[model samples]
Target: MDIDDFGPKEPTCRMLEANDKRAYFIVRDWNLETANSLRRVMLAEVPTLAIDTVEVIDNTSVLADEFIAHRLGLTPLIAEDVDKLVDFRDCDCEDSRCDNCSVTLRLKAKCTGNDVMKVYARDLVIESMPPSDKLGQPVITDADGLGSCIVKLRKGQAIDMRCIAKKGIAKEHAKWAPSAAIGFEYDPANKLHHLDLWYEGDDPKKEWPADEVRIDLDGGPEKTDEPFNYDAVPERFFFDVETVGGLSPDAIVNNGIKVLQQKLASVIKELTGVDEANAGLDGAQSPAMDGGFGNDGYGNDGGYTTPGYGGGNAYAGGTTPYGATPYGGAPGW
Candidate 1:
């Protein structure tokens, strides 16, 4: 029998709602540790492209050199296939700044009109990049073509610079963070009373406004009027993930899962002194662990296969059978 049948059932995600930059989903069968790990990975471990170095060629605008450089470093550059790019440290280059490791963008904006002109992120131009590198496109927040405002310039003022975007995670700097904010809450109704919430006014609900979990997911613990369950435990989780246009919300969740799997693989290797990836291939029996350690999360039920994962992807681009419910189990509760 397959080893996955012996361990924790894999956790599954049902996408509640999604847009270009945000997604609402619910995860089931995951313990507090696994759920919290995924949340932290999405916030920190998922790699994305961001501006790391800024070289100001010339600046006559009101903004100082340091200020302009700082603004340039914070611009959100979009590269949908960011996983194809290698991080600077992992590249084969002896020194940093190679076609494989870095992407260079140029910004040259001047105020030709008499009135003050606003220089936006769209003003930045993709100067040079790797052969397969499609990086450093400014994210458009609105239809006005004003992506993210860099700096304003008066008439006869101008700014010129070159920016370098590299692969990185949010742990290094906020510039590389793909998410704006991640809403992680299990019991929104306080029926669990996980925390002894303090309230000064008449009621606690009025003072501590419910988070987006209650407002969004119907599957979440939003039924405040229902009877408080004295015997309930925090089993389900409501995740409202808002990304910053760097990676898709689907990708963020998928990537987080992969990161956890990798960590588990390392632990397995250290404990058993055997490579888990090649465990059963040689007709040698290895230890059976949770379904989370399996390559494909499905319990091999009906020959069901996982989708939305190929290269360095965290999620399948399309819907999977795992959706519509928490589907399976994982290592712990």
Candidate 2:
């Protein structure tokens, strides 16, 4: 079947509300399955930089080293430069860490002389910064102007640790999720035009717009003749998304689309047995074919056949109840 028979090649999007942290939009001419796929990608596939490993150098505080590491991993880091960052597993470096694949963050806190102290995300020192203007400091701050508080310490207590941040998707962990919420729903306004408002309410005039109310109650419940048409449009969906300050709402959506495209490209390459690196080469041959019956290059035919039950049908002697024929065998063979 032709590919176009599946669905529209391109879907349309319309933005209704947009801001730094939140966005609401509409997608037209797309099925519910497509809309849901976009939402899933936004929530779980968009990549972001997050603290993945921690090395504790010293700790005499109330919190254990593992607890501290857990808190550090949850602290959202500045991930706007994720596109420029490489995954540690995919990097060429043979060691456990490298500049291109990971960034180091250090935190040190001490409390002394009868005073209680608090350690926050701002205290985590980023050893290096990416060469991008869009990214700021790595720590995330709350609306109260306080960074993500790691722990509290009593007098004479101290803590010191180093963390490694890496680029990853939310599917690995919640710390890497770029968006807080992503969802879509059918627009209800599309169904409003089909309702008969006249007979549904006490005072029909008060229940709907003047143009929608058609009964002339003052003239004895008679209906005024008017031409009208329902305005319901099919396959329209409204989407709402919220970002987690690691990236903008728009960036999360754009990245989700990019990730989806890459996944589709990979699937197509696998199914077509095409080596993308050599696809553009001069006179590069296609992969060896697996015939309809999946035969090896040798002459042995590989297809379903009834062994003792079939003959004279397509195979050579007597006819059988089951229709079993050799691969590519003629009827008289």
Candidate 3:
């Protein structure tokens, strides 16, 4: 069946607020499942570049190599055009390291004389450019210099390491998560009626942000004559997304929807068994061929074969397939 048969063909979305790192929107005509799927995908399924493995060539600092490597893996990298990047598992190269699947970041820092030095994310430089033009730099940076400070160094301390950044889902590790948080709530204004606001002071509106307080004064009843109504409109959800600076909040949301679409398409393909090359053939047929056998027309013994040949059946007299002794019966039982 076509996907449109499941629900509305096209859902409507209205942007309530948006910025570089955060966004708030309202989705209409979609079920709770759809909204929650988007939320989970944004938080855990959306792929982003992160330092997965760190190789410390030399470390003269007081910190252990394992600790330094752990810190490196937690640092988020800039990932703008995620589609252009290839996942490490999908890359053609057989080895664990490859240019197409990973980017190398090098860091070499040392403190001289009485000077105290600090290593930051910016200090670690991308060895090569990513494939996409949209991704100008692999390291996330701003006017404040680097995105975050990695470690501090004393006058005689030094650190040298190579970090490998690869595309990964947050399910494998949280460092790959694109969004910091994704959540949604039912908008009460869509159906709630007789909403009333009572606050002290001359101007009640001044107490809070204008966007925070919203009352539907004309939906069902008068506020002065009735208690507050708690009803909500169905199929309407207000969503909020916060990014971890790897990508813009809008990009995270869009990528989440795209990932969900791809997953659904894969499910549909598996269920329909529509092989593009072998169209019109029976798709329901099992791929495995049945070998001639004694019982079920296949080689499977159904656990009835003699011991030392195949394996004894579950009700066998000597020993069951799981090594348990059968109770009160011959091999047939």
Candidate 4:
């Protein structure tokens, strides 16, 4: 809620409505950049537990190992303490698998009766899963527990497998995604002209109808309307987020904000390092980083142009100077 920490403008987001699967909110006093950043981060940055690797000990089912594995990967998992788990690649343990970074799921099903049996997501039993009774399983929509039919088995068909779940983000693989869908919109009325309606006639109202939500919220267009303001900007953003499972809509938004904060903090840290390094070199000047343009850059008072691409920056010589980053240290840039 203390959005001042995220930006200089001190924007705030208010939840308009929310439920188990979906949430609606509005962010005020912010620009398009910040609003879009939240949307993208929510889509691809939020972490979740997914079946990354599968071990098939025995399989007599019709589906191939790869096919069954792919289905299991896309199944929505309930990861309550996903943050407590670490990425397998980042774990410090010597072993390839451990409790710190890996979860084991055991699934074994066989059809004994004459009737055909179906395998469901609920069939996958949680084993070696971290202890977290605080977060109970979601309400099962039906007897199958909202699990789609993975594979059907005849009288003797059977399957035995153990799946390995790991922590990951949607950017790497969509199986780790938490959000089902997210709707982001700003300036819904289009008063700012960010999107122009291309209609055949002069009055576009006949062909293009106004958004019902806008009409309802703003009352009749004739009852109350404000003239277009030249200084207008995207100061309010509306968001509606839906989650697949485990993570609530509020949690998804909060986690996305945390990821965005970390990214901004990283950039700030890198910039601070650059600023310090830029100040260390004595009388060193780089037109690129320091933004000095007066009498030093190409074809100045001497009427002589600098050679090579980028003209007078650190890349002019096609080599990095001082063994440092392009923005910090050295005099070429």
Candidate that scores best on lDDT? 1
Ranking 1 against 3 by TM-score, winner = 1
Q: What TM-score does model 1 achieve against the real structure?
A: 0.73
Off by over 4 Å in 3: 1-10, 133-142, 188-233, 275-333
Per-model C-alpha RMSD: 10.9, 13.2, 13.6, 11.5
lDDT of 1 by residue, 236-297 (tens): 78888998887778777766666666666667455434353343222211212344434544
lDDT tens digits by residue: candidate 4, 1-333: 544355456677777788888998888787789789989999999888888888998789988999999998887777677777777899897753577887777779999999999988778776774646422222234554656677899999899988888888999998877898999887666666788778898787688777777434423243235666778667788899988885878888877876775676557436434222222221122222342322243214321233222334433333343234545354865
**Which pairs of residues collide in candidate 2?**
311-318, 312-317
Clashing pairs in 3: 303-313
Q: Per-residue lDDT for 13-70 in model 2, tens only?
A: 8787899888888776776676778889999999898888898988998889999999
Model 4 residue 21 CA deviation (Å) reads: 0.5
Residue by residue across 142-197, what tens digits does model 3's lDDT show? 78766677888899889999888888999999988888888667645433422355
Residue 84 error, candidate 4, Å: 0.3
All candidates in order of TM-score, best leading: 4, 1, 3, 2
lDDT of each: 0.72, 0.68, 0.68, 0.70
Candidate 4: regions farther than 4 A off:
1-9, 134-146, 200-202, 214-227, 273-330
Q: Between candidates 1 and 4, name the one with more favorable lDDT.
A: 1
Point out where model 2 deviates above 4 Å.
Answer: 1-10, 129-136, 139-144, 189-234, 275-333
lDDT accuracy of residue 207 in candidate 2: 63
Clashes of each: 6, 2, 1, 2
